[model samples]
Target: MTEETRNRALIVRGRYDLTVPERALIERGLLLADSLGKKEYACPILNARFVLMPAGTFMMGSPENEPDRCVDETLHQVTISKPFYMQTTEVTQGQWKKVMGGNPSCFKGDDNLPVEQVSWDDVQDFIERLNRQEGTVKYRLPTEAEWEYACRAGSTTAYCFGDDSGGLGEYAWYGDNSEDVTHPVGQKKPNAWGLYDMHGNVWEWVNDRYEDYSSGSVTDPESSSKGSDRVIRGGGWRYYAWSCRSAVRYNGPPDVRVNVLGFRLLSLSSHREIKSEVVTNEQVTSEKLKITSEKLKKLIRLGEEKGFITYDDLNDMLPSDVVSSDQIDDIIMFFIKKNIDIIDPDERETLIVNKPTTGETSRDRDFIAYNNGTVLDTRTNLMWAGEDNKFGINWADAESYCKNYRGGGYSDWRMPTLDELEELYKSENYENVIQITGWFVWASETRGSDAASFYFYDGSRDWYHQSNDSNGRALPVRSAK
Candidate 1:
């Protein structure tokens, strides 16, 4: 084929080769990936299409000001240093059957629908079989960071489209539109990067262990073996729009498979750049040995002795070596938070005291009461509606109640966001102005037919099904101004 015709067809499929034609495309920088838009590759064995995602940097978590943001989504800079190929849509039942000789998807018949109900361990077996079939270990699940990077497709908004969940209907099959069933892939508009069904299809299993993020910059982070829980991203057909947000994260045991859980393959040829070599006596015995318990203890000791590791600095470190691979989440949290300037009680005290004040001394239990049935929390510079002696309301009605509230001489009162309610959890004990009991209170964050709520008793927050008809009190709040 002519070089011109060859280049045009090359854009459609990329096979691993060192041919003169491929070399010419490489010279033009089109063989490896497209600089703009998508680079498509059709897997010959499974006949599945994969899209090439360009390497770029993005804030990996939600901003503090983002509405309905979770506490674990601490905003941090992340760079995906290398471009990789990600499946355009989720792995389908047909593709799974082709590779593994069987499909485990709950929703069957449509060969194009994403394969679900496959555990992380089951996916590993699928990957192994696929690798053996392809004669290369090029297919694996994307790392948590890689998954988010690709999902965002260069957009930092809640959804790949933008902040407004209303636009999500055009791009996702979520709680409002999915009719509680999986649909064929690529039915909705693809993200800016031309990857389809990223927002809502099925929750895709990633290669990272779920953990709280540190507010610092990171590069090529792969939480491969950090914790026991394998990371899952994207919202399923049964979930709400909020769960499908780019920064939202959920995780489960590697062996646990649900009808809503599936995974897509990530292809990276640069895997050989880093190789695991057996530790020899000479290397391990060296004085400046890199891998050892002593070094880690020394680092921890330095953190205790002096505030040596800044929170930002700790965030930049690769999390793989921060804690033992076998460590449970509860124990690993101590080291992770300690390195990030959080585990220390003194640091916590300092954070609470050193806030921009609204002339509210937290110790005095000061609250500026208003005639319109609202109280100003001067410590947090937020206005809260006086708690009503009622049980609760549905999430929809609770949000409506906040918007219609004319209390505290404010017409703009609305249900507090999850982040805002989380702030009250700590300060509530000090200021008993609100009669908050053990009951959960509704937050503004919604996922499909579920909404996020905070419990004042243990200060825990979780998303509950709105259809369950469970009751949760509403605590409306607005800006102090």
Candidate 2:
């Protein structure tokens, strides 16, 4: 037979065990003979299956005698909490190419050999693409917690099989068994969990955002929400056997692709969703006040279609005098308290008059003292000095304005919603200086044809273009504290 066919024949035959039974040989023959239709057997050995691993919890990480133990791997209780099926051997090049479209492995060997030299990101993309073709989301990288738990396989020792590293040759292909190169997978004995090459093959990638471990027990602890690097686990054939210990942890960047990196898949178990408890009104009020204060200070933006107010007449109304830095700081603090509705009535009166040596500045006092005589949209102006102004614009133009328009020399701006605009109104004295003659438009966040606008005149809101034509004239724009 040709060398290529000879290798294929070798794979079909499989390895001999330390002990073999007569019944196993006969059963192999019967299965092959039947499929070959009474002809002499070309390949007598076939149909052998790898053993599957059963799931349970196990202690992860190293004990005191380990070569290099970091504080992050402090012995803490972890639970897998679910069963999953893992490959009996590391994924071979032939199987990888079949599932993924291309082969990027550095070492080229027999089709049955384990693929090597892939990165963590490359593996994730491969899994994502494979799931699309397979029509299932059942495949994913095992989380770091799952990897360690599986590697431990109920063993509390440094190595899953035992504490001594002398007999590693019997179960793994490490620095000694491997001649500075990866051999075909599954050439070694399986672990107690019936998994092969978990200790040494290629360093496998695990799904986790890396973080230091906490001292308490954690059930199925995934990584943190955000991190600079992702976690990788398991040692490779190129490293020392001690490095292949069950509890050893390592990490790498999510985007990195390397020759020594590869991954295995895990399937999630079915579970019920848990709901959180309700929040109190006091908490809600605190949150709403914070949001309101932030919204009030944000510069009002005009949409692209609506443009901005650029009249020289309006610009000329702004005062040329610069407010002292100390006074400006006090004014900002006053406005923040007012927006949060925390200022007392007595404090409010004293603030409006600019009286010196008070506990704190009032919103009305600061508004009149710092911005009372200024214009709204001037580069030289730092604040909008008006209580009531008619600002109107189409919904589309308003969004664009907030996104791009720079006011008070600041670029970050967003259009105010109806509720935000209404916060500026005084209900008790509505018919005097606050009333303006115009059908002005206020911005709303609602999108598409269901878009809405608020009317500043009566504090009433309705969908934009609900009663009027879709095409309307330029809407005025204004800003507030």
Candidate 3:
């Protein structure tokens, strides 16, 4: 084949190789064409934690007339370039421990408490350790500009909430709510975009060199090219609520460690260009089937006669015929059915035997249960029990929890809607299971209106019930494959 034709084939298949014919170009051993075409690449794994900040221009500082406005807090017009992710809250003791091997917070109650008394140098050490642990060198302290940009979250107000300090209790634990000490991070309200403790938790160390703002808009600004002290921002627990303004600034030596000091880390992400090829079944030839239809039919017949197909027989017969290029889907479906018989039958039979006797058995055995522990006619993989359970969560919260759940060999669990829940009820004795005390509270798919719930005690469908009053418990749970 011609070198050009071979190159074209390789390019179409998205494969990179060093082998190429010499006939296409090497005249007198001098290279003529660029044979190494660029191939698309992708990140097989990407994990970077970030908080989404909204986009807007805000007054960069507090007014001069405002109480406790430091000279640095000069009112100015600062236009945030765009929306971006910031740290969700100040770095917590738990997170610090993960990197530093010790907790430094004065008020160490929960691991979620904001880490304090850590110097800028100590924070850098923690960042280095984190980078090493994660096997990447992208992690570092956020530059001072990046810190202010994220803390502000596109808001120009003194606090992301507003100018009024009276409402500080809702968003932050300052001098009043702090009780002269730092509280756990994220206990108070979040900013507009759900970030917590961006204002008053502790002073956060940033990576910028301390310097005054320069004129004009800066894109991806960094700290001074050189400086002795690093920039610090955000107010501490002992400070007044207004001191926590988004535009506020402070600086400290890298070695200075105090009760109010802490730091957050940032990591630069590498972007990759991915080229994905869509291969249709039609494109695959019959010879590449891996398993032929005739073979599958023979196997199925043998299974029916002998009650099972031996692995030896399956291995001896090349699968190439059992799966045809055109019949790929059918072969896959057949194998799926066989696998289900091997894996799901026993569990299904157990569920069927345990099912309350009053319910009529449907011939279709493919149904699975939803979050309420009630059987759903459709396939789902969630398990649930009622209130006496630990983790109290509403439907939305429960749904979020279930989606993240990695249990029972299944990851596609979800909260069922009211209709889906009702379908599981034993219609004949709905009240029995629906109102069953201490068993399970049915999760309703309904929203904006009162949520519907069922009790497992009597197995009945009920509506307009208050989740708080029913004594029906919501069991935060996941699904089983």
lDDT of the candidates, in the order given: 0.66, 0.49, 0.51
**Pairs in clash, predicted candidate 2:** 117-259, 119-257, 302-401, 303-397, 303-398, 351-365, 352-365, 392-441, 392-475, 392-476
Model 2 over residues 119-190: C-alpha lDDT tens digits?
A: 776777666534433323345788887777767667787777888888888877778777777767778877
The lDDT of model 2 is 0.49
Q: Give the Cα-based TM-score of candidate 2 against the true structure.
A: 0.45
Per-residue lDDT of 38 in model 1:
36
Off by over 4 Å in 1: 1-38, 269-481
lDDT by residue (tens digit), candidate 1, 1-481: 1244324333322212122322233223222222223356676667777777777789988988888888888888998776778888899887775544345678887889899988998899778656533434478999988988988988878889899999998999889999999998999999887888889879999987888776679899876456799889998898988998998888899999788988889886331121122212232233333333344455456555654344433434323332322122212233332332333344656644553233222333656654234577777899886563143366665665566544423457678888888887777553456655327888888888889988777778899886433457666688977
Report the error of model 3 at residue 102, Å.
2.0
Q: Please provide TM-scores, in order, for all candidate models, with all chains considered together.
A: 0.50, 0.45, 0.45
What would the TM-score be for candidate 1 when compared with the true structure?
0.50
The digit string of per-residue lDDT tens for model 3 on 311-349 reads 344445425432222233222223322321111323545
